[model samples]
Target chain A: MSPLSITSRTLAAALGGYGLASLSAMALAVTLPMARDQAVIIGIMVALLLCSGAAIWAFSARSAWRAWAGILAPGVLLGGLYLWGLPA
Target chain B: MNKSFRQSMAWLHTWTGLLLGWLLVAIFITGTSAYFREEITLWMQPEVHDSTLQPGTIDMALAALNAKAPDARSWDISLPGPRQTAAELRWQPAKPPEDGRRHRGEQILMDADSGEVVAPRATRGGNFFYRFHFELYGIDRLWARLLVCLATMFMLIAIISGVITHKKIFKDFFTFRPGKGQRSWLDAHNATAVLALPYHFMITYSGLLLFMTLIMPWGIDAAYENDRRSFFSEVFSRGEDAAQPGSPGEMVAIGPLIEQTETRFGKPVERIQITNPNRDNAQITLRVNRDPAVTDRQRGGDPTQVFQGNTGELIDTHIPANDPVSPGWRIYNFFTSVHMTRFADPLTRWLFFLFGVAGSAMTVTGMLLWVSKRTQQLRRDQQPDRALKMVNGLNMASITGLMLAIAAYFLANRLLPVTLAAREDREIQVFFIVWLVSLVHGLLRPNRHGWIEQVAAASLLWFAIPVVNIFTTASHLFTPLAWQHAAIASFDLVCLILAALGGHTLWRLQRKPLPAKARRAPAPRPFNTTNPASEQPAGESP
Candidate 1:
């Protein structure tokens, strides 16, 4: 792929990592049996570390498509699981 | 996309670090100084140095607050603790209509013993450095926090990338060889970066967490339904509100309760906050010193105890039980304590401060190495590049210029007339003005000479501050009067040590001409050797 395509992919991965982090954090808050406040705290901590890891994965990938897959696949999976667990 | 992982990481590291390195330097320097924020505040207000926390100091502080703000709904009394000598008081004036929005009210600095106001020199003191470390002055706090947080995140990225890119990071930690141009700069940067790598990581990450709610509100924003106060109250385990009785009751004396709290905590009570004073259901909250040591436990012991104002009966408390407190809150305080270091003693605080200085040094050296590398390449090609010149000026300005500005700020604090209007703001203005002038000076002058002048200027200013203090105030390095006020004396002594260090820096800069590598290093691209002198700019110093 061209440099421009690569740059775009990198940017997406960065934002995607942040998005995944926020989603997973929200999921933790909803799922933890402890008080809502405590859940929020634990969730945010986990999310911060996850975001950092995701950032590294984004840059280290061999291709832009792979980076996108790395961030989005887990994000969608976790987010979907969170939604499924919620009362309809 | 085909580039190796280390190569790509190097690209990321270089750009992210270059973009925010200057801001990081300033932030690290000021934040490190803030380890002694209260002591700096005290030293600036020299009149309070002789005062000590007397028995019943809390009662005197409460009485002072009562007499001053009788109609106040609540009072915040930061009583003379182990770290502070003045009882810093703030009140919620009954005059301002409560709209659930906070506003600054009357603030007073009183002697905890005498219960009289200590009319010290009006200055922002070290608080200027402390606040500017995170929320820059004269700007909207949200905007400032956002900007700092962005820089912090970038810093985090750079640190991670930096570690990844340097394959021999541990091996390089022991490396240092001065005066080798880009080589020396790289070694210095690596040494500082790798030496206190853990500290650098902890300080950066915890700093971001301390301002987490301010910056990353999404988690709480969702969980608490956007009500910030409710979110905070829940996270902190807010106590139940006491219902007010219609009729007033005779209040129990506060002196004994304060003594009881002191004994209970094995530490002196720092403050006694009275809410709804003189009301039938008034409540008194006593706070003791935060334990001054780092522990691995998830739960921290809160030092606050609440009591019924009328009966002196303990109503609510957050002090940790013998069993570990709530695990979640423990994690929260663990992060908070690491960043704030309220638990650390002077020795530990100094260790943290020195690591912070090393981190700042790492940033400066990294930036200079970038400039030096480009300059050498540009020189070998016999190209006079405008961008190189611009980077040179900025390099001189951001690092040494910042030092000069801080010294000038201390100088201004001492030299400004005692009764000048808006005195504190004026001191801060002088700080910025000097800093701006240094940038302009850096751009216009020859880079090498410009660096020398700024370092010399910084040294002179640092040396002058204590001398100025000797004349303007009672403290001096050798004076008997200074011995009585150890904090003030040590402050002056530290000033002297910094001055000597600055002098040594000035000497080093003068001893070294530009690292003599451009002439000898292999030229990346050949250029005319016939007119090397023409490449030199006019008005160049000998």
Candidate 2:
């Protein structure tokens, strides 16, 4: 659409990619022993989902907020969990 | 984004990648090798033939240490196990009063049986390789680390910008067109970078964080009041807090302590440090850890226990998984774990090794891309541009010449006398001298010829390593292989394979036809004529 929107979309996608990676890593870290493996598998799955979501948002979203939402949702969730639930 | 922003980023990505690519390749190569530093040490020392340690060897080793280094402030004894040869004792004397310079500790290599000092060897063991990646020889460690840090930051930027620049990122995910010069280099770079994107990101970011104290020291320095030891202890869970040393008392038997450590951890005691050993407040810290392994992540969840030196009583315990550390600290640990791969099994180590090679390939291709892209412009310009030529020379020297230097270092390890004074330092000296020599060779030769020559030299050196080992060592590849000795033979074989690849590369370079377009002389300019009749007459004659 508009150049501003496209730039916002690109930034959103970049953030989304970073969010996916961080969340996947954090999820794997918090889960203990046997559940850790399962957590990592889930994390990988989630990361892929987020990555695909970002791609779709880049192409399809008419509004910049929607593109940003695709990334921010995962980023905020991951950051919150890491700060609050991290093992001592 | 505006075209200027995109263009600026593109320029940033290109130059940053080009400038740092060679250093990055060195880093990846050394880092990967550092994963097998212990194995390399084992290969270097043929005198300690087998992995097994003699019974009561550690006790005897300690007796020697007590006798030789009684005045020393602290003694660290590393017990011989599967990965190392000889029980080694290191003791650092107090700083001298006049100059206040600390002496580099005395290292006594004890015989496994008699516990007498063996002929001193100069090899710095496997740890040197680990140290080489961050603390490059001849450079201050702080400066080297900073350089590495800058390189890593640029690398991260390049990775991010590269992804942004790739228009068909997913569509060309698996594409690799083999022989189309510049296009092929781009394809190779993209494939390597994309396929291992996770590895690339983790490695680059973790590498940067590896020196985070240097990069972002405000938190750690402010918190610890700039006390590095305290910071380390708090972060790494090192050194127990104990009461002041009491009067000298009878020390307890270390055998039971060793047995206790082994039994508790299901791993052999790697090292034992007795703090204030002569006093009643003596504390024995038994370091029982898993044999270092190579994996995607190096340090795994393992516990380190400390016990009282005299009573064999438990003092304190540090388990990385259970330690109360900040998220930043844990993140740092996670990066180290990934970088060192100490927790990995053999199969996983192989995976990391392959990835390390892929990382090296990414750097090499990036450098090659610089030259490949500029070749067209240089050809179009009748005369060879000096700046482009210099860039071409530097790319060749760094990419191929560094490999030759490393090969030369391996050769020097074999050639250098073991009994020579400061032998370890000498070996390291050889490494730098050879590297410097390669830089000179690169600068002096024609750019294209330099690559061929350096690659050929590297190939020869790699080929020679096994033959030299066979001549010098008792264990050769033909001998029945054991787990402890397999690394030595395998390393040699890997060198040979590298040599073969280098040879093939050199051969291909030799065979490349000179550019047909570049070879043609520039079209002669027609003589200027003011007379219109003359110009028409020329056209008519033609």
Candidate 3:
């Protein structure tokens, strides 16, 4: 593997993956119809698993750009969901 | 990413497993030791070794507390249990000094039988290891927790990728080939990892969950409008009585209350909390030893009974098993409780300890496999590069060096003067100092000779602990008191077991390792025809 490719993938796995997980957690916490504490807990639990899955996706993609695309695409979707679900 | 999905996973596993393998090994070792932290603390305090269980222990402790802190606001008596030899007495004075300062409380150790106070040497005991396993020592708590969280994340990814990469995990569980150098290391790693697969997965996942608030707080922030404290108080709701003390009156005997609670729970009383002592409104709360179920919350789940101290009448009873919990919280409790293993009996605790050993072995063998694979790839007469040598040095230090440091820590506890100023901090200093020395030694000599010498040194240190205990403490291995106190005896036995393991490692190392020429080389692979069932290459590049 090229140095630049490895470095980019590593960044995507670490930073982008974290961003995606956070957005998902926020989205689930706000949107899920349950007790606030239970929703928060389920959100955190799912977020942790998604974080690891993000790492796997970051490494498994065909190219560095694809790695960033895979993480960021869902991240943007989750971010939008989070804002839309926020209490008015 | 590589040509195939499995190849990519193998690559991911190799890097993730190697990058933080050192920290994971240390965490596993120390965290595993935390299973017996109370026992370890008891063993370290030899002064209380002679305090065996007695039927009158509770009365003795209460009598002593009554004499010592008669006018205190509250008294807490922790009764002796299977792992404990002394009853702990703590009291909060009714009034603090006029000056504005935090008066925490006063506490003393009382022998179970005589109720006489005993002063154990001032040492951190097992708490040092228990704390170091997570937040680490001398660093900012938040930063240390974050660092450990990052490692745990990496461990989770490594576990997932490792499972994907090992195509024959089930088959490999039954296969162990010794005397084959790199292949043997790989086999041992696979065996340990696959054997305790559920434990490895649970431990890594729960480790991340333990710090969810610090690492993944977005959920709580979004749900509660950034009010974390309210969230915690809501989840762990407790009923705190705010009753004022009544007129002074004679209180009823405590023995019957204890017996009544024990009969109700079918478990011995673990602790007694008395408020408004010697008053008409005095309330005694008895918490029995935890009888934990798989889904029970770790804290606040003990079977407890409350009594009217003056009348000796039952006021309230709480059976934690009957508490209603949502499925989400139940799942969370199950994972966290299993990870902590606080509910385990002696046999279950020992089983968890052995599983922890297996986890440590998995990480240690993985590190060795990395080095062995790279070392085998080197052609004859080709010296190892600087980076390779550095990695080897770190591997040795994090493994053998850590063992040496722990031994030195125990030795320091015994060797230091009991009255020495800041004795606890001094003992910790000895641990870090020895660890630093081992790192330096590993860097100076990261070869066969270095490995042999360090392992030998660590083995001798482990062997020396029981010998040194004879000269330093009354709870030596040969003493009847040590036998009576199973904690102390088991502590010595574990040390000898460790020393024997080290000796076995040393003995195996003495047998000359296979030459580098005989091991497999990292060459371009041809399609495997003989093993048509498995098409994966024998060696994959990092």
Best prediction by TM-score: 3
Computed on alpha carbons, the lDDT of every model, listed in order, comes to 0.75, 0.65, 0.85
The residue pairs in collision within model 1 are B298-B330
Best by lDDT: 3
lDDT tens digits by residue: candidate 3, B71-120 = 77778998888888889898877775566653557889999888799998
Model 3 CA deviation exceeding 4 Å by range: B96-104, B241-247, B513-542
Score every model by TM-score.
0.88, 0.74, 0.93
TM-score of chain B as predicted in candidate 2 = 0.82
TM-score of 2: 0.74
| Per-residue C-alpha lDDT of model 1 across residues B1-542, encoded as one tens digit per residue | 57999998888788778888778888888888888887777777767765677776677777887799875767878866546677888887766657655567678888866888878878898889999999987899889988898788778878898999999999888887565556667788899999989887788777777877765666676666667789876555444543533354556888888777878888777766777777667788888766554433333354878888888999977664443546775776677687788677778887887888898888888888777666544544354366766776787778878888888888887788878999998989999999999999988874667877887888888889888887877656667756665666777777788889889877766664453354455555333232222222111222
Per-residue alpha-carbon lDDT of candidate 2 for residues B55-103, written as tens digits (9 for 90 to 100): 8787887788778865455678888764566787887653324555455
Candidate 1: which stretches are off by over 4 Å?
A: A1-6, A32-34, B56-59, B94-105, B221-230, B240-250, B293-301, B304-307, B312-318, B321-324, B379-384, B480-485, B513-542
User: Between candidates 1 and 3, which one is better according to DockQ?
Assistant: 3
Among all windows of 10 consecutive residues in model 3 chain B, the one with the lowest summed lDDT is: B531-540
